[model samples]
Every structure is written in C-alpha cells, then in structure tokens.
Target: MNTQFIKASLFAAGLLLVSTSFAQNKNDLKNWPSGYAPLEVGKRIAAHFIATPHTNFGRPTPPKVITYPESCTWYGALKFAGASRDKELLGQLAKRFEPFFGPEAKLIPVPDHVDYSVFGSVPLQLYIQTKEQKYLDLGKGIADKQWGPPEGPRVVAASHEFYKQGLTWQTRLWIDDMFMITALQNQAYLATGEIKYIDRAAKEMVVYLDSLQKPNGLFYHAPTAPFYWGRGNGWMAAGMAELLGSLPKNHPERARIMKGYQMMMASLLKHQAEDGMWRQLVDDAESWKESSSTGMFTYAMITGVKKGWLDAKTYGPAARKAWIALVGYIDGNDEVKDVCEGTNKNTSRQFYLDRKRLTGDLHGQAPILWSAAALLQ
Candidate 1:
C-alpha cells in the first residue's frame, strides 16, 4: 500500500473505535462504556501525581517544580482521597504538604499574582483532612498573605485592572484569576470559618464574572484579548462553582453568581464538539480540540451537577460525555494529552490560536482529578 493509503486506513480504524465507545446514551450510567469509572480515572491521574516531582508540601521549594498547577494537583488529590476509602492515599497526598502543617514553616509566597493564593490550598486541604491546628493556622496565614488584614486584598485590588471598554488581562478581570484567587479564599473560609475570607473570594468572583462575561454567556480571555480562550472560561466555571460551594444561600450575591454560572454552562454545551472536547478557541470552528480546558470544564460541569447548582437532567449527560472524552486523552502511563501549556493574556487572538500543547502538564492532570472525584460523588 502507498503511504497515504496506510495513513488513511489507520485513521479510519481510530474513528471506528471512538465511535463505538461514545455511541451509548451518555445519561445512562449503566450504559457508560467500560473503563470509564470516575475512581479509575482518579487513580490514573493520581498515579501520575505521585510520580510528579513538582511540589514539596513541607518546604518552600524542594520538589523543584512547585506552582499553582502543582497546588491544583494536590487539591485534586484531596478530592480523590474523599472518594476512596483509602486514608493512606489521603495521607500520602497530605505528607507532601506537611511543611505547611506547622507554624515554623513559612512559604515565600509569590506576590501580586492570584497564583500565590491558589497554592495556599495545598496546606489548607491538608488541614481539612488532618484537623491539625497548625494546618489550619498555616492555611489561614497563607490566606492572610493573599487577602489578609495587612496588604493582600489591597494588593489584588490595586494590581487587578478592571475592564472598561476593551478586553485585557493586565487588569485582574481576566477569567483565570477568578479561580486562582478564589481557590485560596474558599479554602481559607473552610479552614478558619471566617466570613471575611469567603467574602473576599465571593467579591472577586463577582468582579471577574461581571467584568469578563460576554453577552453570549462565555467570557473573553482578557480586555485586550477578546477571544474566548477555552481554558480561561474553564477557570471561570470551576472558580464560580468553588465560590458558590462556600457562599451561603443567604448571601446577596449568590443569586447573580449562580445565574451567570448556569448561563456559562449553557453556552459551553452548545460549543462542545462531536468528539466531546472544546476547541482552544471555544467558539471558533477552525480551532483545534484542547484538553486542559476540557478537563477544567469537566471539573466545572460535574461539580455543578453534584452540588445541585445545575439541572441534572440537562447537565448530567453532558458531564458524562465530557468525562469520557477526556479519558481518551490519557495514555497507558496516565499522562494527560493535548494540555495547553501555561499561558498569558495576549492582544491577538492568534496568540491563543497558535499556542503549544504539552503532555503531563499539571494544568491538565489536576482538573482531571477534580472532575473524576466529582463524577464518582
């Protein structure tokens, strides 16, 4: 056979396999294809998390690769722990963050970025699982650094630029910050039972959502970047759910936040491609299917369903489809595929259009865990 014929044959076979796998009714839990268990998916992602050398929960930087993505990995680890009866799995995950379990161990937190607060959850999750006062103190302390009495909240307000007439990331209005800032604040609220922490997170959610959400329900990547970057909207969705989880029903802003989150999901469902993934540029027909955002969006959708924040009849099947499609991206070794690498706000739509893809990136791995945990719930 000629080279072109061989390639075509292989492609055709791949399509057949995927078609058979996804042909079942997604809403029928009994009919979900084999090997799609949420626990199994969580385990696959966790195996990768164990091998990951990016985080050191005990110190400021021992694993040589700590960042918000690493923090996200641990957050998912906590979720995985919750689903499994295995306390050891939870412990194994918490040990990495043990450095923050004590008062003496201090983090040299990254400044002027919501990513810094995102990392606080590493310790905070440990505190939740262990109930060690030190972990709680550590979590709250880390939180204070983000929105604490001294300068944390002020810094974010001053640093985060609100969008006016144009789309931009230079201001804090970017959708990605919605998750980064709220991750820390929500965890802090849980750790300390402090209304202020939750308030800080809740307020930021409104700020970002109001500023970035488009008339179509999706959000722009930033003021200058008008493109609907898939992962950025994923961040907004997940962040909204996280905040709502902590916000009380009586809170005045809960209604607005919930309405916006629901509308966002509606928009996302419309854009979901035939294979169950969203494009890098969410609304663009020509853009390539992206995974990290798919994973984050999966986390958002399943979470909303579990929390009763979304209509199960409408979102349940969509969540299942998203999860199944995302599973296809994992290799035998547990590495997530097609994850867009770390990104920044860009003035041009083409910047996101031409972004590079990576495997085993924490941005993808962490959200997969979060989604799997919720699905199993």
Candidate 2:
C-alpha cells in the first residue's frame, strides 16, 4: 500500500478509538448502582453550594452570579445539613448570610428587586430551624416590606416596571414563585401566629395555580413562557411537598394543594426518560438530559412517597430509577458532574438544553443535596 493510504488508515483508527472510549465511559456511567450514600452525597454537594459565593448573602455576583430563585435551595441544604449531624458546615453556611443583615439582625436590602419573597424567606426558615434570631429578624423584615400591612391581603409585585413600559420586570407570579415565597410564609405564620402570612401564601398560590395551569394539567414555568422547563416544574413540585408538610391538615386549601400535586406528579411521570431521568425540556427528548431537574423531580417524588401523597408501589420504582440515573451523573468523589450552569432570561426549549453544564455549580449541588436527603428519609 502507498504511504498516503497507510497514513489515512491510521488517522481513521485513532478517531474510532476516541469514539469507543467515550462510548465506554457513557456505558460505565449507565451501569452505576442506583443506591447512593445519602449522608455522604448530601454533604459533598451542600459544601459546593455553600463554598461558592457571589455576594454577602451566599449569592454569587456577576459576571458569575447566583439568583434569588436558588436561595431556597441553599437554605434547604442548610436545613438538611444541620439535621444530619453536620453542625460545623451548617454554622459556616449560616454565617455566610450574616453580613447581609443589620445590627438589629434584620436582612438589609429589604423587599429586594429580585425574587425578594424567596430571598428573605430562606434565611427566616434557617433561623427557625437553627434558633438563630438573625435569620428570623431578617426574614421578618423582608416579609413586612414585601407583603405589606400584617392585617390586610398581601400583594406581590408583578414586576418592576421602568419608564411606564414595565421595563426590566420582576413582579409577575410564576409557578416557581410558590416554592420561593410560600414556605417561608407558612413558617412565619406558625412561628408568629400571624394569619396574614398564611392568607398571603394561599392567595398567591391560588393565583399561580389558576393562571399558570395548562390545559393538560402541567403548570407552565412562567406565565408568558410557552415551554415547560423540567427544573422549573421541579421547583413547583418541591414547593408543594414542602408546603404540604408545613401546612396544617385542616386548612381549607389542603385539598386544592393536593390536587395540584396530583396533576404535576402525573405529568412528570409521563415525561420521565427511559433511563429514569428528565430532559431539560420536559416533554421534548431531542433536548439534552438534565441532572439538576431530574434531581429535583426525584427529590419531590421520593418525599411524596414518604408523606403518603404518592403510592410508593407505583412511584417508588420510577424514583429509584431516576436516583440511579442521578448517581451515574456524579463523579467518583461524590461531586455532582454535568450540571447545567446558571441561566439568564431563558424562554424556550432550546435555550434550556443549550446551557452548558459546569461541575460543582450550586444550582446542581442544591438539588443533589435534596436528592440525597430524600433517599435518607
């Protein structure tokens, strides 16, 4: 054979080898055991969310930034961290938000421009869990400013309008908003004996559920957005689970909340990938597989089974399968791998899947922590 022909053959073989290696790695990941070490995995991922900082409140600043939408997640991880015999790490995470508070222990920048409800509520929940007055005061300050007078109906800003055109908006209630604000409201009501907070949570939840529910039972992530992002839905599902756990069984809205739960759970089950995970675009498979969303869904489903909201015989197997898929995405050291990094102003299916995954991002770690916590329960 001529020298040129031999060289071409060698190059083709090298390409084939590279492809084969990648295929093998994918298979190895797929074959990983479904059962995960909850305590160990939760700690590792929670550490990542706490360690990465943006501003004084454990929020990342630009050009690398963390949004208020993710605040509940960090707080949730902190809650789990404190509960799981990891006081040292929990204390450290709590301290990160200390700088954001005032001398009276109230959170500064009250009624924040971004998702203020969730941002403030998280610290409050942490305070309640840890008996830290600072978290409580900060949370109360936010609640006072955003929810208005303690005696009247609480009004949430639909968006921050600019120049009368409603430019640079942030006020509209979305499905994910329920997760961000209501849980804290419930905690506040329980702690303070303030009926207003509970009333506020109920009203806003009704608005979100009524306005955002699609004809098919799945709630859209945002009011104006047409596409459904799995993580967004996961946020709503997780919110429902948390709210159900906190709300009294006799509350009038309990049935409505349960109905919403049934709707979302049914829709999510239909969208589960063959490998036991969900894609970034929930109903669309051409999009990339997403671990964060899958983790969130698995977290909600597993928690539901524990709470009797779901029949474990039917959902448990699927949850276990998703958990297995989730572990396959993690690396050998228990860190979350291939998590899609923070997104900005997203509105479409392609926009979500097109996001690049960065290892150890808090967005990924928070859900991973929840996933592990669910398994432990």
Candidate 3:
C-alpha cells in the first residue's frame, strides 16, 4: 500500500471511532439510566446552576442571577441535602437563597403579591433541618406575610366573587402560589409550633381546590384561564404533597386535602407519557415533554410513598422511571435541558404549546432534586 494513502485511511478510521464513542455516550442515557444516581445528577445540576446562569428569560438577563422559578431547584437541593444529612450541602444550599430575601434576610415584600414569598421554602427547609433561629425567623416572616390578610388577585379582574368570599389569605390567588406559598406555611407551622399556619394553609388549599381545580383533576393556570400549564398543575400537586407530608394526621382538613391530591395524582398517572414524562400543556398531546412538571409529579408521588400516602409497589417504579428520564435531561456539562420558559396563564392552547424550552433554566432543577431526595428513602 502507498504510505500516504495508508496514513490517510488510518486517520479516517480514528475519526470514525471518535464519533462513534461520542454518539454512544449521548445515547447511553436512554438505555442505561439506571447506572446514574439521581442524587449525584441532581447535585451536579444544582451546583452548575448557581455557578453559571443561562436564560432567554425575555427581559434583561443578569449575569449569574437567580429568580423565583430557580427557587424550586434550590428547594429541591435543600430537600436532598437535608435528606442526606449532608451539612455541607445544606449550608451551601441555604445560602443560595439569601439574595431573594435581601441582605438582612427579612422577607422583602414583593409589592402586593405572594409570588416572591415562595423563596421562603429554602429558608424554611434549612430551619427545619438545622434548627437555626435566623432561617426560622426569616421563614416565619414570609409565612406570616402569606398567612396574613387578602391582597386580592394581582390581576384586578381575577378577584372573582368566589375568591373574595372563600379564600382566607390577604394575597391574590395564583395557581403557582399553591407550591410557592403553601410549603412555607407548613414550614412555619413546623418552625413556630403554630397550628394557625397549618390551619391557614389548609383553608388556602381548599380555596384553590374549589375555584381552580377543573373536573379534569388538573388546575387552570388562573381563575379565568382554563389551560392546564404543566408546571402550574405540578405546583398544585407538589404543594399539596408538601403540605400532606408535614400536616398532622388528625388535622381537620387532612381528608379533604388528600382527596384533592389523590384525584390530581390519578389524573397525573393517566396523562404520564410512556416515556415517563409529562407534557408542557399536561393534557395537550401536541405539547413538548416538560421536565419541570415531570419532576414535580415524581416528587408528589414519591413523597406519597415515603409518607405512606401512596402505595410503594405502584408508585416506586413510577418514580424511579421518572427519575431516570429526568436525569437524562442533564447533559455531561451539567446543563438541564428542555425546561419550559416563564409563562403566564393564557386563554389558548397554542399559548402553552408554543412556550420555549430552554437549557439550564433553574425551574428544571428542583423537581429532580426533590425526586432524588424522596427516592433515597
């Protein structure tokens, strides 16, 4: 053989092998996800998130910033760290929430809204685990804010007669508030040994369940909107699961709350794609595979198993399957992919169907972390 041609052929063969190995590493996730630990993958993703911020967040994208949605990811980190009893991870995760509440760590008011109060979950989780007075105080502040008088709906027209008459909180109702605010209330109850917070949380949940939950067992993104945006519904389920995980068994509202949660979980079980993920619209067949909602549903179900609220024989495999699929979305670089961008409730199905799915969006991180924590049990 000619020397030059042989060398060229050898180089070409080497290139082919390199390409083959790269492709295999990529595809191996779908086929061999059981080898990956959800906790490790979750930790890596959370670490990468705080280190490098990525977004097409619509408005100005600040360098290395964290926002409300990403709070969920950190909440999951808190859960994972607390579950593992890893003091280092707990301390690390707890500090990540400081900015949201301001330097003094007081619950910086978000004008007349309850949305920003969701960040309380982080401090509350830290307080619950560490028994640190600072976290407890901050978390209590937020819970009291959420626990206080009705601000009414931020969308003026959204304050329907039903909400005005039925809800107890001073804040306007948003579907996201379910997970955003409720968990903090439960935490406040735990933090202060105050039955009032838990009682208020139960009333708040019923108010939402009455007005927002459609017969389909999923929530409308808002009062006037009938769309079941995946993450919003996921928030409802995850929040309820969070509440149930901590609420006293004989608490007056436990039966009603569990009924709603079970109804929603049954619907979630029905809608889950065979691939172990839920869609962006949740009910819409045309929507994309949404990682955040999938994470939330898995958290809800796995929590049920851990709390003895769900049947392990049934939900355990489902959660593990969901975890496998969820971890697959995290790339070798630790970027979480296919996370739906920030969305508002809209009247049309196309609105949800068209939402952007971005890589490393913080909203995708929490559910995976929480799932890992729950599964570790």
Q: At residue 224, what lDDT does model 2 achieve?
A: 67
Candidate 2 residues lying further than 4 Å off, grouped into runs, are 1-35, 55-66, 101-110, 149-171, 332-335, 341-349
Ranking by TM-score: 1, 3, 2
lDDT of 3 at 59: 50
Alpha-carbon error at 257 in model 3, in Å? 0.9
Prediction-by-prediction clash tally = 12, 9, 6
What lDDT score belongs to each candidate, Candidate 1 first?
A: 0.77, 0.67, 0.74
Task: Report the CA-based lDDT of candidate 3 relative to the real structure.
Answer: 0.74
Candidate 2 per-residue lDDT over residues 68-147, each given as its tens digit: 63575676676677558677877777777666554423433335443545677667767766887767776776665555
Higher-scoring candidate on TM-score, 2 or 3: 3
Best first by lDDT, ranked = 1, 3, 2
| Candidate 3 weakest ten by summed lDDT | 26-35
How far residue 46's Cα lies from its native spot in candidate 3, in Å, is: 3.0
| 1-377 per-residue lDDT for model 1 (tens digits) | 79999999999999998887666455543335678887777887887787676554324456543577877887888877877755978878867666543642454354335676577787787787788777777567667765433343435443434323221122366789888878877888887788887877777777777788988999998888888998999899888888887899999889889989999999999999977899899999988899989988888888887888878778878887888899999987788888887788888778887888877777888888888777666
TM-score of 1: 0.84
lDDT of 3 by residue, 31-58 (tens): 3344466556756865775675433243
Output the worst ten-in-a-row residue range by lDDT, candidate 2. 160-169
Best of the candidates, TM-score: 1
Pairwise lDDT winner, candidates 1 and 2? 1
